[model samples]
Target chain A: MSQPGQGLSVGLFATCINDVMFPDTPKHVAELLTRLGCSLTSSPAQTCCGQMFTNTGYFREGEATVEAYVEAFADCDYVVAPSASCIGSVRHQHQMLAAHRPALARKVDRLIKRSLDLTEFLTDILEVEDVGASFPHTVTYHTGCHSLRVARIGDRPQRLLRAVRGLRLVDLADSDICCGFGGTFCLKNPDVSIAMATNKAKAVADTKAEYLAAVDNACLMNIGGILHRIKAPVTPIHVASILVQQEP
Target chain B: MSQLTTLPRDTDGRLTPAPPPGELIDMPRFPINARHELANTDQRNNLQAATATIRAKRALRVSEVPQWEDLRQAAKTIKDQVDRHLDSYLLQAEQSLTKAGAIVHWARDATEANQIVVDLVKATGAPEVVKVKSMVTQETELNEALEQAGIAAWETDLAELIVQLGHDRPSHVLVPAIHKNRSQIKDIFLTEMGQYGTPAPADLTDDPSALTSAARTHLRNKFMRSTVGISGGNFLVADTGTLVVVESEGNGRMCLTLPQTLISVVGIEKIVPRFEDLEVFMRLLPRSSTGERMNPYTSMWTGVTPGDGPQNVHVVLVDNGRTSVLADPIGRQTLRCIRCSACMNTCPVYTLVGGHAYGSVYPGPIGICLSPLMRGLDSPIDQSLPYACTLCGACPDVCPVKIDFPEVIIHLRHEVAEHKIRDTKPHLETTAIAAAGWFFAKGRRFTVMTWLSGLVGRVFKAKKQFGAHMPWPARLWTSARDLPIPAAESFREWWRRNHERP
Candidate 1:
């Protein structure tokens, strides 16, 4: 493993959903970054990025959330979030919020330049293609909505996956399509949610791979839950899980 | 904040009157086949041919202009900057309209907005009104409200007339009757004309011109008779207080010109600050909507045009839930929409289910965002609208305004997930994610959880079904789909056993 001096001094933004709901993502992200010689620290105050309140039409709440986000990560060199939703929010929404809330604008301006999703940070910044991990399994990747559309993190995950030894990357058809997990949309519209999830589940099943990996865990969980319920013999793992892998 | 009105609160503390189509709608079990609409093969063929022909024509027309993308970008930027200062723009729009002899009424939701218009018509002492095709009116169900008030509201657009006469809702924006074939339209025209006034000949055949002629004849009397004209504005210029409506049919021109009193219901987002800005949008709209180089009749009226048009013009600027949408930073981009329906034609999901499945007046990719914004995320139907997409980038590709639809969708999903966590104590998703976080945090726990998952997979081995074994909430998965059982050994276990020598 490369020494910490050569590593990227990445700060994990472990967005609200991943932090409170799935903290393991950040843990894996930190481990993977370490393997790539990325020195990492957890930003404790890096609470919810306010993506939720902002997108739901709560402007004042969104502003407050943006303030809290900027305050938490203001000192970090780089804010790396596990969620494309949060990273996308910081990159896109923060600038808009800055216009309305002038006091917090500067912080947001700085945050935008440094903020990135896990895949983009690892492959692009660290220049680490394949980690020295060996797991001979055929894995298919499902691209999350925000990562692909908002952040435009194209081919970064694929590039990282290509470098993994013994890991055969089988491209899932229509992989860039959403897995139908639109957060509150699922609860409000469970029927449509299932329809979207079912279609994504079918696509994942069609790939005939042992593992289904992606940069965003939200999509994975939705697809994984459906696949798990349907008994599709595929495991859904985060891209960090594979990228951080080391030989025994 | 002082100039802008806070959305009035209801007795329940939520935004008042609730959002439209509030009732729960079950998600379709399977994909809605376009073939179901095949019974109207003539209509289907007409729609397909029309859309395709227009699409090609638009491509040709647009290619001639080297500044097309430049114009689109300028429009988007203007809209973006305006939306950022939306509160000020709305205030300015209201002030300008009020200054120009127009009364401005703020509606918090659709019901309140409809009631305001119905009351406005009643006060005018007019028993009938003529209308142009306006999405805002459709959204507020203004025509239905007028009928409930015992006032007859006439649709002037030939296609809108067909939809109204046949007791059907509009399927497409520009051509409301795009889903109805020529023969079906001829039947509607033959039957409904006499009830309204002019009748088609008994020998009239199902020809497009014959149907149009029948409609023109039937609507002529109402156009001349109605004292009040109800309309929706395509663009309400805040600078000069000019409202623009672009249409191929001359009916809109008649509605504006013939009426004594004109009232236009406009959404808050349609405001363009200046007249010159119309140059950019005017070109983009027709080319994108009808695929025409220019609409045949482009009507522009400012307040009262003396002897030229209606004597009294009242522009009702509606807030509904638009202010709420504007409040959202990520979602604010949706306001940049020009309503060209380019997204609708290119959408794979929309091409299949068409508009009705959306269960809202606004359908397609735009509908998904608009409905939920107009409504709240609380109702089953409104909530379900957002998921009615595959998140393909096709909608964004064709967008003249370049509203990133896929971005808006994921942003909406983030809202949905956050709401679920906040509103409830702990749901299945939260619990499952929480558990995953615990297990995946450490190597030992990860190994143990993987083992447990493998064991559970084994239980379904006999039946080849894992869905049957899932607990409640998670059982929503097996409701329609079946899961394949897991292998006896996991990838990790296999890797450990065989690759140890490496």
Candidate 2:
């Protein structure tokens, strides 16, 4: 693992999904970092990790998006994103996607080494599990596939959740299987996707937890969407939001 | 024999070759098939229960092997070596088998392979043959061809027998009739087994033992009388010309030993260069496939066993698009598959929709890569197979040979898109992706689009917190799960208002 630069400065990569659909997630990420005594900065030039295009098989478009991303975060000490999917893309896919461009690939490799998912940045780099947050609600965490399998950020989010004051963390069955929000896969094959989502929703409901929290909002959006559509009692919340919660 | 004359055949007494193996298109697309399958509660339940049970057993068995990972790597390395030099290995296998008194024939495709089997059967002048469960035979649609040639092929494996009697496609590699529960098996047996061979008892029940007993009684008579036995080889040892069949039931053993003449149809990729390589595969196959520490019956024969096994031994090495699969550097890795079916058993999509949706003899994660490469991906069903996965990475995780299914799926997706581009079709997805790519290529453009989408999303907001339904292309998403409405304020905009720029 790369060492954090002097004085705790980090670049915020508010992944395109969060930037557009769940903007509050990046805000909470920022707030949580601030509470952890880190200085945060955002580049207006940053957009996405190009995961959408790459995963959907548009390599040319994915390459362009990746190039833009690398250009945006090239000089940052450590780039933090609230999304494991985006961080996973940057860390795993970008180098492959940009392999044709040797210089760009090298830059992506460097950026990937420095990139961290939100909880990863907190628990690993910041060395702070508890960020002085309080959320008194029964919650269950669904570890997104990329986070668990790719980024290998096992139990980091759960560890932080466990540290939250007044929070009751419950276990979700088969929490590691995908919630079926596989970018275009959900739309391309909705029946299978819906069946998988229905299973996930049932598992979440079985937990009887008031909130279903995960690192990736895209998964939450899918699981949360189904939960809301079926009028399930549980609601989806981002881990960053939960981590940044105060007495109120 | 009465049923044979109605089917058309050539003047040479050969059934007209079926369409080239991979070219038998027009199968329903995956989503369409999955839709109907999803509605079949019984199939869904059967698949869920069977796969879950097998998956647990497999995990436990695999965990018990302390050197499981090393064994998997060894298997992968051995298979990789085999694939890398398949031509030489195949020649070596042929030479070794011939030296051991086995007649070896090379089949370039399914049609030629079926022709070889039929001609070999006709030479025996036998109207009936017992078959061991072989995926290669299924891949070639050999039974249909043999029937066309006026040969009665009795499926001897219990699950394969159930599938044959029910007139159903094999839904899984390991358990051919996994979609059929005990009751379904009893129904198939009670109704159809009599017409084929020995009839089931009038009081046959859905109990597993009863079902097996019925199958045993039905197959036993055929096994006794059949002069020819047909099978699919699981592994072909190139060094000694040994063909190995790893199976649970004793049916494979019966088909191997009972008949005077035995023919094994094997995919060329099934070759393992060295006999010692079997050690790796033996350990991996059972644990990965049926979740057994070891399959109950493992039949190995090097040519004719003289006085013990069949006096006439013939092995047909079938290509059937395998060489085409081998030509692809990335896709050829799939050739390493030992047909453990571990990937299918663990795949979430396969578990839900069952194997019929894949529209190929092979299904699930391995099928997604194999079918397209073998069939040339021109068919709509084949094209859609690659997208059937959620890319959950489970299949690769459990793959004994470590085929990296998601990577292959993604690679094939690219090929499918390229194929579309070659056809000059208007792809909505391509257009939307291009537009998104343009937006992301420039930060200003991306920020503007994000703001616009957010504004539009808020404007169309419904009473529900998330958009209950969306229009057109987006409607695909909303049909199942609600699409989360874009935030009212873009994060960049919020950042502009509150935070200092870097």
Candidate 3:
């Protein structure tokens, strides 16, 4: 397999949640991409892809966020995000935002095509699954609802995890069910949200893995919140954090 | 007649509680109702088990069909075509039904539909009527209407029977009593059966067949004695004037056949282009709904059949807010629903709280999409229905009719937000959301916002609120789970420090 000889121009979209809250997750992605021989750049003009506003019914606000995002990432070769849900919103809702505005619609079309989830970027765009990483722990993967259904990026993260030198990949039971971190849904319907997260949390514990790996940070925040609240031993880790590891 | 069975009359004038006034528009919000139902641990556990069983079975049954996607597309196309020319198809159905000795009545809404059925039953002079499990009739609250007219409507389907006897609203479409376990059902039967009809033996066990037998004994006389029967049509084949009802129990078949007079309350959207349309739906419905290869009993009746079945046949075609839904291109697709309950079975939200939380005749994804469209989002519950989802895409994947649930949900949310048509006026959250939009429109604004959040995180950390619980608004999220600590140095700051050249 011939790697891109010089380097690829890759833009990092540290999704809003990850940028402000869990900086380590996107930092791991930046480190991994840098190791894989990519010229990484972050646009200071970018905050989020407007997923929060989009999903929560604030379309006017969401559209503005999306327009700012396009302005930031329009020139990049491929824009990669560590979160599937943010990327999903960019891909789906951005189009919806531009449905009435033809000028923004064209730019959105171009930006959305190159926008990819970190896993999709690794496995499909770069054609690299094993990122030559190492993690000696039993990790169960939870496919977030957007990653599994909306983005439809299958087994890409798992394949990368499997290649990690000392990692033991265990399958989580009913891994496709949402972890109830449905952004607004968590706060809006906490009772139902808690029940759903409890169900996912049980499935996470059943694997008895040391860590739960998922593509989206929001889902981790939810399921991980439950595990933490219960004083469960499992630590929730992003797929990027696992893939960015080395023996030392 | 096979034999003269002793009809168990309500010797006392006392009747069970009437069904609610109507089922289209309901009262409580999703979160409020969800909170109440979530407290019912027993119901939650029961719903989980029942829905899990159906989900597994449905997946297996669907996998058996090699061209299941093709069947789904075919069904969508057929239904879409009907929606395109609904007026013509409905007229053709009415004409065909009339020609075939069936009196067809058009009802503008629930009141009119209920009145029509009450009058039809009154003309028959039957004190009691047997009923098939029908969602449309459930939506109209036909039983309550009949009760008001001094007619006792005995639900013959086992699940509907349980719901009726328990004096509870249905939580599921196919399995209305799914929230109750066999033991709970046994208790309901034992305590309430005597008040309605045949009393259960003092020693009725929780065994499935045993409970079933008790229900059977209770309903046998109703089927034998009732001269009037009412049903909700699953699909009204317009070209043939045929009404198709596919069911698991023989009760629906009995109700369709045994009575001297049969009145079926069908929604206008139930019309199909042709009789052959059943070929697609028949293959899809049972497999999608009950996960059966074929439903145990399928009853098809065109019209009056001399001395064989009901000599007096009446079909009430209802148009209560359906045309308005049809007018909406996005919402028009909702009328394509066959009520398979696949979306509900697959919905994670529905899995936790069951159908009662939705508070409508339709529940789960269907309820979310259809209820608001049929019954405007004027009420809190109807408005809340659209927001009661995770946008997980599970419903659309499982929906036999391919109703884009997330699309409809998002569209509905847009309606609520843009129009300011919410029950709770002047939302406090609206100010925050609008502020967020302004803050998020530019990257510099977001940087400042994150910086502010980090400052708050430091303040909260000093107060020990970060890992434990957050401030007032965040407290909603932090109550059940730990609050995520905002980063001291965000990724952008890190980039500016290292990667971004000064």
* Candidates' chain B TM-scores in the order shown: 0.81, 0.94, 0.95
Please give the RMSD to the true structure for each candidate, in Å.
10.2, 3.6, 2.2
lDDT of 2 by residue, A77-118 (tens): 799999888888888888889888898888888888999998
TM-scores of all predicted structures: 0.64, 0.95, 0.96
Q: Give per-residue lDDT, candidate 2, residue A156.
A: 92
Q: For model 3, what is the C-alpha lDDT against the true structure? A: 0.86
Candidate 2 wrongly placed segments (more than 4 Å): A1-6, B1-24, B461-469
Name the lDDT value of residue B166 in candidate 2.
80
Which of candidates 1 and 2 reaches a greater TM-score?
A: 2
Q: What total of clashing residue pairs does each candidate reach?
A: 11, 0, 0
Which portions of model 1 miss their true places by more than 4 Å?
A1-248, B1-69, B86-116, B171-187, B203-206, B406-419, B422-444, B457-482, B487-502
What are the Cα lDDT values of the candidates?
0.70, 0.86, 0.86
lDDT of 3 by residue, B385-439 (tens): 8889988888899989888989888888877776562535777668788888788
- Top of the candidates by lDDT: 3
Best by TM-score: 3
For candidate 1, give the lDDT of residue B156.
84
i-RMSD of model 1 (Å, 1 decimal): 9.4
- What is the DockQ (computed on Cα atoms) for candidate 1? 0.07
